[model samples]
Target chain A: METFILIGITGIGLGALYFLIASGLSLIYGLMGVLNFAHGSFLTVGAFVGFWVASKMGFETSMPEFILAMLVGGLAAGLFALLIEQLLITRLYDRHIDQALVTVGVSLVVGAVLGGWFGNDLRMFPAPLWFLSAIDIGGAKIPADRVVYIATAVLLLVGNWALLKFTRIGLIIRAGVENRNMVNALGINVRRAFSTVFFLGGFAAGVGGVLVSVYSNGVSPLIAATYLIYGFIVVVIGGMGSVPGSFLAAMMIGVIRQFANYYATGLGDFVVVILLAVVLLIRPQGLLGKVRS
Target chain B: MLRWKYSRPLLGLLIALLALAPILGANPLSRPGLQQTMAVAFIWGGLALTYDLLFGFTGLLSFGHALYFATGVYVSCILINHEVVVWWLAALISIAVSALLALLVGAASLRTTGITFAMVTLAFGEAGHVIIQRNFFNLTGGENGIALNADRIPSLFISVANTKFIYWAALAALIFTYAVIWWVTESSAGRVFAALRDNELRVQVLGLNTQRYKLLAFVISAALAALLGAVMLIAAGSAAPRFADAGVTISLLLMVVLGGAVTRWGAVIGGIFYSIATTRMQDLTQQESFKTIPKWIGGPIAEPALVLGLLFIFVVMFAPGGLSGAYYRLRLRAITKKSQ
Candidate 1:
């Protein structure tokens, strides 16, 4: 029971990380009808910056200060996302494929530059000491950091939900996702929603990057890409543009991968990929996605 | 002067030169090293042309082409080393398997279009990459990669000194690929592919099943791409995980775009040019002249991806038509000038 509890909670933690990346992908694809290929770059930037800030500012011991670094990292990524949106993506207008291509170019440039500057080895990310400690729950010593993951995901979900429910920007975004043509017909500047969604996605990517670095205990140029694939899987399985669906899919994938890996050693990834194929074959629109006409 | 009437003779002359390249001249062109490079370029030329059949001629923009290419390489390698199959039989089987896979993956992936199509293909390719790395049954050799069995390899290609034969083989593959593509592009089915690219809905409105046409293009291109892999496996004498990386597919995309999409010969040019330029760029970084340049400016330039990536962005942004596009534009201006 204790082992199951430990695996379950950690699985949820992994799912939380995936959600952080998937939510942004879902929202952007949902509203803008654009698939941001450079989305993983956003996370990479945030993680490196967050690590730099925490180390330089000597915040390794303080929980609040480290959290501050994570936010700063997210802010940097958000700003970068805005720049990409305005500079490259918006210029292409409605050429969706071209826009995606530009993001690929940007990702390549960024990836190479980072590799040139920092080299391609893993670097340890400093986390608060308490993060590594475990708390006894149901006779299982679960790592305390997982609680933070679940909490952050829940908080972001609720916060995003409230924003979509209450705010005018969120209203436009929600409307845009449902029917862009309808929103445009109603004289809504649906374009504004694209920017908001990119920024939100960027910020969330940053936070996830920092948090995942802590989870893995290291940061590398290649780190986000592996997770990004899983994020893409989560989005596809969850259905593009559906936040709640992403959360459910992420948790399911995370938990399944945990137990599968435990049982078969190196079989987790392959199983997940098989699952993705099955889902794609059976439910092309994803678990909660609307039938796109 | 630039008439299409002279194209056939010009192509014949070009083929003759390529065939005689290893021995025709002593001006640093016939060296074994240079021949090896040219051989690889020819294979890439063939590979890129096949990719064009799918992305350029047809409307599908698949990002997982590396899966087919890698499938050709690893399957052949494993069959010979592990299953003890003959090299010729292994090559044929790899081609067959790749085509069959293209059928299945295309059947599923074709359900989506545009962005979703790209993502679905990418997911499938990534799955292949991971599976190769997993080294199931010790056949794939895992991350360390697998070597071609020496005794199983054909006697003609056994010695490293026989690189010239490999060069001829690669050139033959490229010519064969080009001929097939040209024939297909001029066929009635090829006409449907152009229509599909321009407007799929319109094709559907014409009462044609566009999905079937797309699958046809996909399978043909995949089989041809596998041929390139077979040639490459013989050229390199081994199979590595690098062949399956997403980067390889992106490189194919770069080739097609740089050479000019939809144009019959553009992909060939793009592939050869990209392969040669990439190898040259890495060499440039090691030159003494590079040391004279400032470290800051030269540092990023040394990373070929940074330079090539920026170039790709420029091409996508400013030169939507690529090299062939540029040639056509110039020819258009010249014709107007002559008339005036």
Candidate 2:
């Protein structure tokens, strides 16, 4: 029972990380109709930049320097996404295939540049000392880091909801997701929404970068690349562009994977893939996605 | 239509010269490294052509085509290397299994359209790679990759001295691939494929099941990729995990796009160009003169991904038609001007 409890909690922690990545992917795909291959690079940029900031700022346990690092990382990633949107994505306009291909190119270039500019080795990312401790829950000892992950995800989720419901940009975004052509006909600047979506998506992915780095032993150039596959799966399963759906799917997949991994080592990934195929077979449009055509 | 009579003889002659290039160009290609590079290029050209059948002709953008190619290698290598079966039987079985895999995976992936299809195929391919790298069932040798067992390999296709035969085999395979693709593309089904790419709604209005035609293209393309993959194993004498990597699929995409998607010649040329660039560019960077270049320039130059990716972007942006498109564009203009 204790083991099960611990494993289940760890699964949620994993899901929390997956949701952070998937939410960005889901929102971006929903609005722009782009399968942004470079989304992973945003996460990587955030992680590397965040680490650099931490190193320079000097880690102080009492001062909460990691939070600042995470914020700065997300902001940097957001700006980078904006640049890509303006320079590459906007030029392609409504050419969805071209946009997707351009993202693939961007992803390759960014990954290569990061690898070439700053070696491909995995390096340590220093976390707050408080994150090193554990808390007991239901006789199962849970890592303190899991709590932070869940909190951050929930906070972001509510924040995303509030932004969408309460703000003018959010209202335009909501309308654009339903029918961008119609929204454009309504004289709203749907293009600005594209940039906003990219920025926001990149921000979430950037945060995911820091969270994922903290979850593991360290960060490597391929860190987000490894996670990007799962993010895609999550986005597809959750119904592309549905935040609430993503949260549910991420948690379900996470728990299922944890249980599967417990039964047999490394079986979870295979099981998850099968699950995706099965989902695709049954629900081609995804769990919450509207029929595109 | 006007010069179809002249084009056939010219094309046949080009192929004949290609098959006999190893002997005719013996001076330069005799270098084992050059021969091996050319052999890989031929296989890539074949793979890219098949990929074009799906992506360009059928309008399916698959990022997971490497799965079928990897299936051919792993199945054959595992059987041969582990002495599970004779080489010929293993090779036949590998090809068969790859077709079956394409059917199953294609059926599942074809359920989704556009971006979803691309992602689903990618996931399935990534899963295959992971299974191989993880050494599932303790058969794949994990990260070490599987080499063709020396004892089981045929006498005609083993050792550095036999690089010539391997080179010829790869050429034969490429020619066979080209012929099959050409024949299929000329058939009625090929017309349907073109229709499906241009407008599925119109095809659906004609009461045709677009999915069935798409599946046919997927299976045929995958089968062709598998055959070339077996040839690839023979050429390289091993199956590395990277054969199944997502990077390989991306490279195939690069080949098709660079050569021009709809044009068969573009696929082959793009494959050959990409292969030569990949192998030779790294070597080019390794040269003494290149070593003295500034770090800023040298670093990006050394990374093939950046260069190839930039080139792909350039093609997509400026030359949407690729090399064949550019050629056709110029030729069409000249004809128009002359007629006027």
Candidate 3:
């Protein structure tokens, strides 16, 4: 039971990171219909940005320093996203295969760039004071870092919900998702909306990247390929355009992975892939997807 | 109808020229290294063309085609090592088995389109790669790879003296593969595959079974890929686990896309271009002084695998129709001006 809970905690920690990364993927797909094969590469960029910032700040335990680094990393990732959107992705809009192919190219370039810049080593920042102290709940001991990560995830989720539900731009973004053509027909600059959505989406991925790096204790260039596959699986399984669906599906995936980690070691990637395949076979449109067409 | 200008006669002539390249360069380009590169490129060209049949003609982007290709190498290696049959017959059986596997995979995965299809194929490919790398090590020869007896096939020319049979065999296979593809692409079924790519739903609405057509393309592509794999192993005298990995799928896709996917001859050209650039670039960057260059820039940038990936990006960005598309554009402009 202790091992189960501990594993579950770790799974949730991973799921939280996945939820953040895939949420961006879902939003981008919803608004733009892009597969964003380069999404994981963007995450790598963000993590590296955070790593560089942490190195420069030379702070060991300050929450403010971490927050600043995250913001900077997010900004950098957002700028990169804008460049892709303007220069490459925009041209391929509404062309499904072209979008897939172009982004794959973007992924290769970005991955190569990261591999070149960082070599193959992992990079990490020390946990803050709050996350450094573990707390025992019942008979199970949960790491302080997991708690901090999960709580922050929940806060971000709530904040995103509030922003989407209440803000004018949020309503416009939602409107755009429902009918991009109609929104453009209404003389609303759909391109600007796409830009904003992409920025937010990339920002979410950037935050996820920092969280993953901290939890894993480092970032590797290969992580982009490894985690990108998982993120796409989650996005597809959760329903391409559904934000809430991604969250729910992420939790299920996380829980299952936790159980799998308990029963089998060194099989986490395989288990997740199998689960995704099963889900795809059973529900082609995904769990929350509304239409079969 | 299109001029039908690129006929089988032209293709035969091209193959004849290529087959005689070593003889033509009897003194120089016919050297072992050049001959080996040409041989490898021809076999790879066969693989890339088959890949194009699926992606370019049928409009199905598969990330697991390497599964069949790799399966062919491993199975043929096992058969040859066990003395089950002659090396030639082993290749046929390997292709048959790989086709059956592809059929099973295609039946389940081809039901969906777009990202789902890509993801499913990727899952299967990774699974195949991992299994062969780990569980099937006995037959696979694992990381050490499997080697074959040096004298496997009958040699016809002096070119076959030292690893020279590879060139003749690969060239023959290349010609055979291209002729088969050319014939298929001209057939009524090939037209339907092309149609399916343009509009599957419309085909279904027209009382034609798009599923069957997709399966046919998938199987044929897999079989051709298997044939290429067989030839590659025989050429290298060994088969390694990486032969069946996701990277091969990426490289093949890059080849097709880089060469101008929809263009038939472009696939072959793309294969050669990709093969030469990657190998030559690696050779250029091996110097100690060159090591100072960023790994992404000049050093490993020439790694065929990495270069292919970058080309995949560049092709999509700059040349949607691929290299063939660029040629077509230039030709059209020249023709229009002449007519004016």
Candidate 4:
């Protein structure tokens, strides 16, 4: 029972990390209908930026300074997203396949650049101040950092949910997702909205990058290729245009992956895909996804 | 003034030059390397043409094409391992296996269009890759991959060098592939593929089963890809899972896009051009002059991937119609001026 709890907690932490990354993909797909294949690379960029900031600022001994590092990393990632959208994605939005292909190209470019710059070695930032000790629950001990990640993810989810459900921008975004032409005709600047969503989405991916980098104890060049595919799987399983759906799906994938890791050696990557296939068969539009009339 | 009308003579001259290359030239393709590259390129070009049959013409881009290619490659490679020395017979079986797989995958996947289709194809491709990779100890040979001795062809041809035989075989296959594409593109079925591309709903409203047509297109494409894989195995003397990896699929897609996808000969030219240019770029930059800029711009930025990435970006942003499109435009201009 204790072991299960520990496993479940780890799973929750993973799910949270996934949610941060996948939510951005969901929003971009929802509003712009662009798959953003380079989103994982964007997260990677952020992670690397955070590492650079920590190193550059000489925050070697400081744990609390990583938040500042994360912010800087996220800003850089957002800027890169903006540049990609402005230069390439804007031209290919009408052609989704082309959009996918271009983003794939972007992924290769970013990955290569990152590898060239960072030298393929993994680097970690100092942990947050709150994660100094492990917490014991019943007979199970869980890392304080893992709890912090879960809390941060939940907080972000609630904050995003509230923003989407209650804010004017969220309402506009929802409208845009349903029908971009209609939203444009209703006097909303759809392009600006799209740019805004991309920025927010990129910001979320950046945060996920920082969290995952810290969680895994470092960032590696190959991590983008590895986890980007997983993020895509999560988005597909959750439903492309659904935010809450991603949250639910992320948790499921996270838990299932943890279970698979424990049960099946050397089969972590495809567990999500198998689950995705099963989900796709039962509900083609995906779980929490409304059927397209 | 009417000199260009005899284009067939020019084509014949090119073929003659290719035939005489081994004797006259010192390049790799002139001697032992000719067979390997030609066979590989012909097979790959055939696959690209098939991809264009669906994507360039039909507008249905399936990223999971490697699935069918793998199916055929693995089957043929396994048969060869078991001493199935007859190339023609193995090719038929391989084509059949791949065609069936294409039919199944296309049938299910063609139900959805656009992003869903792309995602499903990717799913299938990944599944295929993982399945082959995990069953390493058995048929796949795991990471190390299965190696075979030299491929055995029919005893009809005289005892020539392995490279010369391979060159002739690949050239013949290339001719056959080109003929098939030419016939298919001019056929009634080809017209329907075009219609399906234009508007599937409209075709369905016309009482045509667009899905059936799409499946047919997919199966044909898969067979060609499989045939190409057989040639590759024969040429390389081995089959690795990397043949079915996503990079090859993307590279093929890039070739189609860069060669003007809708044109019949575009894929062939594109494949040859992409292969030659990418392969030769490293050698070209090996000159003292080319190395300095790459070093200065970014240390060792002269890598093929960097060059490829830059080239692809340029093509996407500027040369949307690709090299073949430029050729067509030039041809049109020349013809119009002559008439005037």
Candidate 5:
């Protein structure tokens, strides 16, 4: 029971991170119809930036410092994404395959640049001392950091949902995702809306990256590839362009991965891939995605 | 109409060039490293040709094509290393197994369209790489990779140690692969592939089975890729799990697009050019003079992948048709000017 509870907690924490990353990818794909392969690079950028800020700030234990670091990290990533969107992505808007290839190229270049700058070694983000402590929750001792991460993820998810549901900009994005051409014809400036959504998605990925680095204790150049694959799997299983579906799929993958990691070691990834293939075969539209006409 | 007249002479010229490559490469006036580079180039060219069949002609963008290639290399090498079969028979068996694997992957992945198809294949490729690296450690030698004993290789084939033999063999393979692709593309089925690429819905409405044609293309492309993989194993004397890496698939896609998709000959040219460019770029980075530059400025230059990425973006934005497309446009201009 103890082991199961621990596993469940860890899985949920990891799922929260995946949810953040995959939601960004799904949102962008929904609105812009581009897979944004470079989304993983945003995560890497966020983690590294957060690490740099936290380290430079001298290992402060205050919650405010950590929040500031995360904000800076996310904003940096968002700015980078905005530049990329303006410079390269805007040219290949409707060309799906070209967009995929171009984004992949961007990812490779960004990864290489980061590796060059950071010397290809894993860099750690110093977590606040209080968050590092363990807390007793109903007879089970859980790491305080896990609880913080899960709480942050839940907050972000709820905030995003509210923003989409209540705001005019969010409504425009929702409409654009369903039918971009129609949204454009309706004179709502869909291009600007898509660009904003892209920025927001990158910001989410950045936040996820900061959280992951804090939890994992370090970040490496390879994180882009690893998380990109996970993000892709989540988006696929959750159905492309579906935020809630991404959230559900991310949690399921997280728990399954934890279980597989404990029982099978190296087979965890293979099992996830097999599950993806099976899901694709049985439910081509994804679990929560609407059927495309 | 113009293509019909020019294609025959173009093919003849290509065959003649390939036949003359070994001789040209071995000449004293040629650069010292040219022979080995050309041999590898031909091998990659063959792989890219097969890739074009799927991505360019058939309109399927598979990101896991390296799975088939690596399967061919590992299976053939394992069989030969274990003395279960001769090299020729091992190659044939590898092709069969690779085709079977392709069929399964195609069946599962082909159900989705566009980006979904690409992601599924990418997942499968990553899984295959991990399995080869971990699950089959004994058979695959894990991360260290499996090396075949030189003496165990059959005497009928030239030893892998001989660069000349490998070069000639790779050239022959490239030629043979090109001929096969050319034949297929020229035939009725090839027309059907082009049609499918243009509009799968229209073909389905015309009472043709689009799925069958796609499967056929997938199987053929996989088999050809596996054949090249076997040839590579024979040349290199070892196979690594990295052969199945997603990077390989991306590189193959880059080569196809760089050469010009849908143009059979373009893939060959692109593959050769990419191979040469990458090799030269790596060599340039490792030079003593290159290290003299500051880390921040020259750091990315040492990473070939960065350069490749920048090149891909440039190509996508400025020259979507690739080198072949550029050549065709120039030639069209020349013809028009001459007529005027």
Candidate 6:
């Protein structure tokens, strides 16, 4: 029972991280209709930036200070995304393969530059002392850091849901996702909406990156590709542009991965791959995705 | 000059030069290193041609084609090293296996078009890489990989250690692949593939089974890619998991794009150009004289990934149609000017 609880907690914590990353990917795909292959690179950049900031602030910093650093990092990533969207990505709109290739190129550039600068070594963000401690609950010990991560993820998820449900910009984004032409016909600036969504996606990815770095205790250039694959898996399983579906899929994958890791070393990735293939074969549109007419 | 009458002769001349490149290397003026590089380039050229057959001709942007290539390399290496088969037999078996694998992967992945197909394939490619690295059944030597014993290798492949012999073999392979692709592209089925690329729904509406044709193209491409992988294994006497990496697929994609998609001969040129350029870039960065350059400016050059990424972006932005497309346009302009 204790082992199960521990696994559940870990899975949920990891799931939260995956959700943060995949939500951004899902949103960008939904609103902009552009699959940003460079999404993971944003996470990598954000993590590194956040790490640098936190390291500079010293270990004595509180949780709020760390959160502030992560926010600043996310903003930086958002700025970068805006520039990329304006200069390059906007031109390749609706050219699916070209968009993929261009974004892949962008990812490669980002990853390579980071790798060159960081010397391919893993860098860690210092966790607060409280986060390093564990609390006993009903004979099961759970790490406080994981609880914090889960809380953050839940808060972000709610915040995003509310933003999409209630805000004007979110309404425009939702409309764009359904039918960009229809939204444009309504006289909304679809291009600006797309740019805004792209920036938000970048911010989400940036925040996810910071959280992941803190959770995993290290960051590396390879994280971009690895997490990109994970994010894609989650998005594909959940159905592209589906937020709730992404969250559900992310959690399932997180748990599945945890179990696989415990039972068979190095089999976790293969299991995920198999699951994706099976899912793709069974439901071409994904678990929660609607058929795009 | 852009007409088939002119281009056909030019292509023939290029093939003839490639065939005689090893003989040309017999002269001291031509370096052995050049021969080796060309050999590797020819193998890459064959791979690129296969990629173009799917991406350019069939309009399928598969990101997992390296799975088939790695399958060929690892399977052939394992069979030959274990004395289960000679190099020729291993190559044949590898080709078959790769075709079968392609059929399976295609049947599943082809259900989705565009980005979904790419993502599915990417997932499979990563899976293959992980499986190989895991050394399932101890057949794959884990990450250490399997090296073929020189004694176990067939006599024909034994001579592959000779740079000239490998050069000639790779040239022959490239020419053979090019001929096969050329024949296919000129066939009725090839026309169907072109139609599919232009618009799949239109082809489907025309009563043609687009799925079957797509599968056929995919299987052929996979088989050829595997053949090239086998050739590389024969040349190197070993196979590594790195061959299955997504980076390899990206490199092949780069070659296809840089040469010009939908153009067979362009892929061949692209492959050779990409291989040579990458090698030259690394060499340049490693030279002692490069140390004198400032760190910031020189830093990116030392990292080939950065350079390749930048090159990809530059090509996509400024030269979407690639070198072949540019040349064709230039020729068209000249002819129009003359007529004017």
Per-residue alpha-carbon lDDT of candidate 1 for residues B35-71, written as tens digits (9 for 90 to 100):
7899999999999999889888986788899999999
Which ten residues in a row are the worst by lDDT in model 4 chain A? A57-66
In what order do the candidates fall by DockQ, top score first?
5, 2, 1, 6, 4, 3
Positional deviation of B77 in candidate 5, in angstroms?
A: 1.9
User: Top TM-score: which candidate number?
Assistant: 2
Q: Can you give the TM-score per candidate against the true fold?
A: 0.96, 0.97, 0.89, 0.88, 0.94, 0.95
TM-score of the A-chain for all models: 0.97, 0.96, 0.92, 0.93, 0.95, 0.95
Instruction: Rank all candidate structures by their TM-score, best first, as comma-separated numbers.
Output: 2, 1, 6, 5, 3, 4
- Over B1-340, each residue of candidate 5 has an lDDT whose tens digit, in order, gives 2264677889789777756654575553144256567878989999999999999998888889999999999999898889888778998999999999999988998888778888888888888898898845478888888997666776534543456667777888898899899899888999898999889899999999888898889899999999999988877679988798988998999998888888787899999989898898888988999889999978877787788889888888889988887878887887788889
**Which prediction has the highest DockQ against the true structure?**
5
Candidate 4: residue pairs that collide: none
Query: Lowest-lDDT window of 10 residues in candidate 1 chain B?
Result: B1-10
Real contacts recovered, all predictions: 0.48, 0.52, 0.30, 0.17, 0.66, 0.51
In model 2, what is the error at residue B326, expressed in angstroms? 1.0
Local error of candidate 6 at residue A86 (angstroms): 0.9
Candidate 1: residue B179 Cα off by (Å): 1.9
The TM-score of candidate 2 is: 0.97
Each candidate: how many clashes? 0, 0, 0, 0, 0, 0
Question: RMSD, each candidate, Å?
Answer: 1.9, 1.7, 3.5, 3.7, 2.4, 2.1
Clashing pairs in 3: none
Full-model lDDT for every candidate: 0.87, 0.87, 0.78, 0.75, 0.84, 0.84
Q: Tell me the DockQ of each model, to 2 decimals.
A: 0.64, 0.69, 0.35, 0.39, 0.73, 0.63
Better of 2 and 3 by DockQ: 2
Candidate 2 clashing pairs, residues 3+ apart or interchain: none
Off by over 4 Å in 4: A57-62, A119-149, A214-217, A267-271, B1-20, B23-28, B82-91, B149-161, B284-296, B333-340
- CA lDDT of A274 in candidate 6? 82
Candidate 2 or 6, higher lDDT?
Answer: 2
Cα error, candidate 4, residue B51 (Å): 1.7
